[model samples]
Target: MKRLLFLLKKEFRQIIRNPFMLRAIIGVPLLQMLILVPAVTFEIKRLDLAVADNDRSPDSRELISKLTGSLFFRSAAAPLNMADAEAMLFSGDADMVLVIPDDFSEGLAGITTPRLQVLVDAVNATQAMLGWSYLTSIVRDYNREVIMARGAATSAIPGISTSPRYWYNPTLNYKYFMLPGILVILIIAIGLMLAGLNLVKELETGTLEQINVTPVRRWELIVSKVIPFFIFGLLDLALGLGVGWIAFNIPFEGSLLLFFGCSAIFLLAVLGLALFLSTLASNRQQYLFVAFFFTMVFILMSGIFTPTESMPGWAQQFNWVNPVAYLMRINRMVMLKGAGFHDIARDVGMLTVLAIAFITLAIRAYRKRA
Candidate 1:
């Protein structure tokens, strides 16, 4: 216990004594959160729409007004013809073009279906799909209003109506969905860099040989080295959560102590992986390259930007081993869904298994020999 405590002191001293490392611990993640969180959103907003209205009737003008009034869409000048509308799409001036045929107003009065054509720029398929959905919803609402205004038989055919209640995030704010994921990324980054580089730095400076010659066993060194980084990981998590709550107004729906406890376990797994990586590299540069490669794989496969279910079967299977994925999943579930420990027992178990496996692997990988 005495030896481990002394080693922990040494590790903290090294981190505190170095200005660059201190800034990295504090500043890097802070800057990344401020810059990236707002930019990372899936919600489609402010799509430019061009109208080619051949009807030029009051009904047609009403439809155009509806489209322009929507928060997702903005009205650009009406194009002259299909050719001009095509040019607008080609020139990237319009994301969607709505064409109301000449008989649109007459068709409504005559009890006939009006012909309306929509040309959507599908360069970004997801954005295009969402934009089309918005347009269709507006048109459907206008159709309902028209039927009501004409005093038509409302109960002729009652279509199926759905009342969707979005829990936790009623407004569907993208930041609410993304902030927890970003916090996970930041902690993983800091834990990996610190643990991976710490041993290599000692090895490069010839102090590792001196420490190895002492009475410290391999497990003692590993535990001592990991303790400080584990604390750091907790500190990083606290900082991120504070910022997320204050700046982005992220909700804390679950128990804070439970969240922090799970985060600590997740950090143990991440820090252990970093220690294992450290055992493979002799210097900081080599560790960096190796760390970066694993970092990219971990982040990409962790379902931060994409859904795990959307990945290939093999990739989804691989996510079982990814601590970051589990942590990200659990954090969001807890925060957004207000899920309890019983709800996330399976994931929590997986993280515990990973934490033990990684720490064991890191212990085996570490060598006292030069």
Candidate 2:
């Protein structure tokens, strides 16, 4: 135990002595919090819209008014024809286009269900989805209001209506949904880097041979290495959560202790994996390359930007092994959904299993050289 403390002190001094690595370990998390919190969002208001109104009638004008009245639409881009609209769309000048046929007003006056064409560029699929949904909703509301005013439901019939209660994202703001997930990423990156460097630094400096001959038990050495990086990971999570509150005004709707506890365990797994890779690789360069490769795979599967349910069957099955994915879902539930532990119990269980497995693998890899 005394030997292990000496080794832990050595690791601490190494990290403190390296200026560039120290800056990276601290700076990256802050920089990401400042820049990316805004960039990662699903709320898309003030979108550029275009109207090609051939109807040019009162009813048509009213429909256009409805579109313009929406808070989401920024302004209408002018286009003369379908070709012009197409050009505007491709040039990124317009996000949504509404083309009202010339007979739209006449058809509406005749109680005809006018076929209003809505054109959306799905390349930026998130905005396209929001625009389409908003358009459909506004049009539907207008139709209902018109029907009620005209006493269209004269029969002894009832109308069935529906309302949506968005659970996690009540405001539907993207950053509120993304900040917690982004924190998970930062912790994973930092944990991996720190873990990967620990043994390689000792090996590179020829200090590891001395430690190998010491009286320290194998488990003590491993725990000493992991404990420091695990704390580093927790620091990142704390900084990120703080920045989200101060900078972006993202709310915390669940127990902070519970969330941090889960995050710490997840980072334990990531740090262990990094140590495992460090054991496999003889040098820092190899560890960096290997760690970088797995980082990409883990983030891609983490469901930060995409839904895990949408992934291919094999890929989704594969992410069952990803700790980041577990954290992403659990953090979002805590932040956005205000979900209790019951909502994320399964995720918590999976993360615990992954942590145990990674720690076991890392210890096994360490002993193989014995």
Candidate 3:
């Protein structure tokens, strides 16, 4: 116990002596959270629209009015002809072009349905799909209004009206969904970078050899190293939560104690992975390359930017092994969904398994002979 405590003191003193490193440990993650939470949003907005109205009729004008009235769309300079509209699309001045036929009003009045052309720039596939959905919704509403005005006979089956209530995020604020995931990323980056670099630095500087010659047991050395980083990680997480609460107005819907408890377990797993990498790489450069490779894989496969359900079957299978994925799931579920331990039991179990696997491997690979 005395030996371990002395080693802990030595580790902390080394950390405190390097003021720049200390500041970087806390500052980098907080800065990234502030920048990325607002910048990385999935909500599509302000799509440019162009119109080529061949019919100067009331129905055509009404349709154009509806399109322009939406907050999602804005009208660009009107196109004079089909060729002109095509040119507008070619020049990237418009995301979509609305062309109303000359006989639109007559077609609406008679049995024939009015044919409207929507020329979309399908360059950005996501924006194109969302833009088409928005336009189709406007057209559907206009059609319903026209049918009601004409007193047309209703269908035998009554139409369904939907009243959607978005739980947790009523306004569908993208930040509310994104902030928790970003926090997970921040934690992992800090833990892995600091843990891997610290061990590798000792190896590079010949300090690790001196320690290896001492009376310290192998388990004692590992425990002492893990303890300080684990505490620092917890502190960083707490600071991040405070930032989220004050800056983003994020709610603390679940148990704070539970969140912290889970975070400690998750940190052990993350630090273990970093330490495991440190064991494999003999030099600082090799450790960095290995760290980056694993970190990149973890972040991309973690489903913070995209939904795992939307991924291909093989990708989803691989995501099961990703520790970051489990933590991301746990954090979001606890913070956003207000999920209890029972709800996140599966994720917790996976993390526990990962923690054991990584820490065991790291310990086994650490050679006193080396």
Candidate 4:
């Protein structure tokens, strides 16, 4: 126990001694949570729409009115010809162009499908899908209203109606879906980077070698190193979550204890990876490179910005090894999905496996070094 205390004391001293490194470890994450929480969004709103209303009929004019009335889309420009519409898209002036072809109303009159062409810029695929879907839905609704008012049920105009009930986010607010994932990412980035840098600093200043002569047991040394990072991670997690609830007004419907419990497991894996990297690196510069490399890979594959299921099979398999992947799912499930213990069991189990694996590898590395 005395040896454990010594190791713990030594680790804390090492952290306090390095000013820039310590600041970076704690400060960057806080700043990131502040900036990125608003930037990452799933909701597509106020999308710029250009229209090519060639029909020029009452029905087409009504269609334009519906487009302008949508909460998602705003008419950015007056109706243009097809050439000008395509030109506007080419010039990045619009996201979508609604081309009501000249024969559209005529087709409705001549007992045919009245085609409404939607020209979409798929560069931002998610937004494009949302915009087009909203447009289509509005047009469909308008068509039905026109048909019923005009008694066109006898006109035999076929239409499809839809009733959608959003599960968690009723208004499809981007903040609701985004805050949890951003918080998860901030915690991981902050925790792992800090832990790795802290561990590697001791090696750089020859502090680790000096301590090796002492009779400190391996587990004591490991736990001592992890405890500070664990606490720091816990604090960052708290601040991010608090901000999400207070500043952003995101929902906290699920168990807070469950969220923290999962965070604890992820922190173990991060600190373990840090310790393992410290064993491999002899100086601060090498540690930075190694730590940054892993951090980049971890963040990119975390599914905070993208879905893991959308990845190819090989990449999905790769994500299975990432601790943040599990954390990402767990965060969304808890905060957005309002999922209970039963729903997140798989995520918890995966994080457990990753924590054990990283810690085991770290222990092996530490033993080899000692």
Model 4: per-residue Cα lDDT over 18-123, one tens digit each: 7975786567666776788777677688888888878899878878888888788888685557788888888878889888888887876756778988899889
**How do the residues 93-115 of candidate 2 rate in per-residue lDDT, one tens digit apiece?**
99888888887876776656577
**Residue-wise C-alpha lDDT for candidate 1, range 285-329, written one tens digit per residue:** 999999898888888899988999999999999999999899889
- Which whole-number lDDT from 0 to 100 does residue 256 have in model 3? 89
Q: Model 2, stretches more than 4 Å misplaced? A: 111-113, 124-127, 144-159, 201-221, 335-346, 367-370
Q: Point out the higher-scoring one by lDDT: 1 or 4.
A: 1
Each prediction's TM-score against the native? 0.91, 0.84, 0.90, 0.83
Candidate 2, residue 216: lDDT: 66
What is the clash count for each candidate, in the order shown?
0, 2, 0, 0
Ranking by TM-score: 1, 3, 2, 4
Single out the weakest 10-residue window by summed lDDT for candidate 4: 152-161
Model 4 regions more than 4 Å off: 13-30, 55-59, 78-81, 102-115, 154-162, 213-218, 336-343, 367-370
Best by lDDT: 1
- What ranges in model 3 sit over 4 Å off? 56-58, 83-91, 109-112, 149-158
Best by TM-score: 1
